[model samples]
Target: MPTLEDEIRRLMADETARLHAAPDLAERVMRSSRSKRRRVRVAALATSVAVIAAAPIGYLTVGSVAMTGQEPTISVVPEPPPIDDTPPVPTEPPNLGDLGDGREFGHVRVGYLPERLQWSQRSVDNGDRYSITYNYKGDDKGSYRVQIHMYEEEAVQEVDDQIQAYRGEEDGEGVTVGARSGYLVVQNVGEDGMKGTPTLFLRMGDRQWAEIMFSPVYAEEFSSAEAVDAELKRIGEGLTSTM
Candidate 1:
C-alpha cells in the first residue's frame, strides 16, 4: 500500500543512507524515483528533499572532524632568573699599603703599593737592569699592576720554579716581602673556582732579587688561595733594595 510514489521512493533511500551518499548515490536515486519523466519525477522529489536536509548537517560535520583529533594542551610558564649585578668584596685591604719611602728601581727601594696605585710615570734603569711599572688611577689596565724587577741572584726557588714551569700544580707560598723571603707564585688558574696569578718573588740578597707582579686584581679582593696567600705575605717586608 505504499504509493505516494512508494512513500517517495522509500524516503529517498533513507536520505541516501543518512548522507554518506555517493556509492552510486542510492542506485542513482532509485533510478530517478522510477521516472515516467514528470521532469524525472520532479527531479527525484527535489533530490529527496535535499538529502533530508543535509542529514543533520552531515552528522554534525562528521562529529566535528572526529572531535578535532586532539591539539589543545598549552600551559607553559617558565623564565625568570638573572640579576647578580656583582659588587661586594672588600673585607679589609685599603690602608693603602704604604708607598711613602718607596719607589726606587736601579738602587731598588720599593716601599709598597696597591690602591690608587701610582708611579706609572714609567721607569727603567740600565743599572741593575731595573724595571718599574705601577698603574691604576687612569687605568693602565689597573686592578693592581706593580712590576718591579731587579735580579742578579734570583731564586726564591727560582721564583717557585718559574711558577712551576708555567703552572703544572698551582699554589705556592712563602711571604714577608720587604723583610724579604717572598715567593708567592700561582699564575693563570681559574678552572672554575677562578683566582690565581699572584707572582711575587722578592729576596733582596743571596745576591739581591726582586720580582713582584700582582694583577689578577687579587681575584677582586682575595677570597681564597689562602686569601691570596695572606695578601702576598705582607709584600716585600719593606724592601730597601741597594743590593
Candidate 2:
C-alpha cells in the first residue's frame, strides 16, 4: 500500500547501490596504474640499452673517416755496430846477403868466412896482445892475407907496424857499422908482399881489427871498386870480439 513517490525513491536507491564501488576497489586501481607505469619504464630502458650497444658497431663502420685527421704511429729500432774480425798483418825481416860459418880465435871470433881458407898457424903473442893471420890453404907466398890484432888495454902505440901506423892511414873513404862507433879505412897498400891490392882496415874497440891486405887477388876477383868496398864491410861486420 506504498505510494508512487516511495516506489520511485526505492528504485533510485537501488540504482545508486548498484553504481557504488567495493571497499578495496580504489587501491586495486592504483596498483594496476603503477604496474603499467613500471612496464613503460622497462621498455624505455631496453630501447636505450639497444641504442648504446649499437654505438661501437656504428663507430667501426665510420672508423676510417673518424681517423682521417690523425697520423698513423710507427715504431723504429736503431742498427747495431759492426764487428771488426780481420787479423793484423805481420812484419817481415830484412834481406841481408849470405854469410858463412863462424871461426873463433884469441879474444875474437869471425862470424862469416870465405871458403877454402885455413888458419896459417903463425900467431904473434906479446904480453896481453895477440895477432892472428889467415891465408889461402896452399898459397905460401902470402898473396892474399888477413891479419887480425887485439890489445887488452886501449891506445897502445904502434910497435912493429901495429896500432898507430895503420890508424893514421886515410884514403878518403869512410864507413860506419850499425850501433858501433869506429873509424874504417881502405888503403891502396903496396907493401906486405902483396901485388899492390886493396886493404880494409876496420879498427874498433880494444877489440879485434883486421888490417886486411888482400892485394891484387881481390882486385882481380871483384868487378868494381864499390864491390870490393861492400865485401870489405861485410867482413868487418862479421868480426865479433870477446874482450
Candidate 3:
C-alpha cells in the first residue's frame, strides 16, 4: 500500500502538468487586446483618409460658386456684324446751255460752257483772228482753263503739224463739231507725265479754222480722262456760227 504523502504528491504533480500544458489565458488576453487596438487604429486611419479626400471636393465645389452666385458655365463667342457695301450717289450737274449767245470770237459764236466755267478774257490775235478764254476755280490751287482760237484761213497754219509733231499721225482721227467735220489732237502741256491737254481742230466753212484747248490741271473739275473728254465733246457739239 502507497503512503499518504505519495498520494498527495501525485495529485499536486497532475495539477501542475495540466496548468503547464493547458491554453495560456493571459497570452490570449494580451493578443485580444492588441487586435482590438489595431482595429481602432485602422478605423481612425480610414476616417482620416476619407476626410482628406472629401475636403478637396468640397473646397472646389464651394470655390466655383463663391465669386458669383452661379456655378461655372461654358462661354460662347459672338459672331461679327455685317459690312455695308453700297456705293455713293453721284452729284447733279448745273445747267449751262445758252451761255454763249451775244458773245463772239471772230466769226464763231460762243454757245456753251460747263457749269463752273466763267468767261475771263478775250483778245484779238493778229488782225483777222481772235481768242476767248474761260476760267474755273475747280480746285485749291491750279485753275481749269479753256481757250478758243479762230483764224482767217481755212488751215491751222501754226498748229498744222502739231499732231504730226506729237503723235506722228496725219489727218488725225476724224471728229464732228456741230455739223462740220473736224480733227482731234491730244498733246501733253506740262512736265507732268499725265495725258496731254486735249485740243480740237476744225475747219469752219471755207473762210476759217478753229482750235479749242482744254487744260488738264483742273484737279477737282474732272475725275477721270473720260469725264473731261465727255465735256469737251459736249462743248464741240454745241459750237455755232455767228455769221
For candidate 1, give the lDDT.
0.57
Could you arrange the candidates by TM-score from highest to lowest? 3, 2, 1
Model 1 stretches with alpha carbons more than 4 Å out:
1-102, 105-107, 110-117, 120-133, 139-142, 147-188, 193-195, 198-202, 207-211, 217-240
Model 2 Cα lDDT, one tens digit per residue, 111-130: 65555666665556564566
Clashing pairs in 3: none
Note the residue pairs that clash in candidate 1.
Answer: 102-111, 177-235, 177-236, 177-237, 178-236, 178-237, 178-238, 178-239, 179-237, 205-208
Residue pairs clashing, model 2: 197-215
Tens digit of lDDT per residue, candidate 1, span 57-152? 222111111222332222223445768989988763222233443475465665556556677655555443456667766765423465666666
Pick the lDDT winner: 3
The better candidate by TM-score, 1 or 2, is 2
lDDT of each: 0.57, 0.54, 0.60
lDDT of 3: 0.60
Error of 3 at 9 (Å): 99
Each model's TM-score, in the order given?
0.24, 0.44, 0.47
- Which has the greatest TM-score? 3
Give RMSD (Å) of candidate 2 vs. truth.
30.8
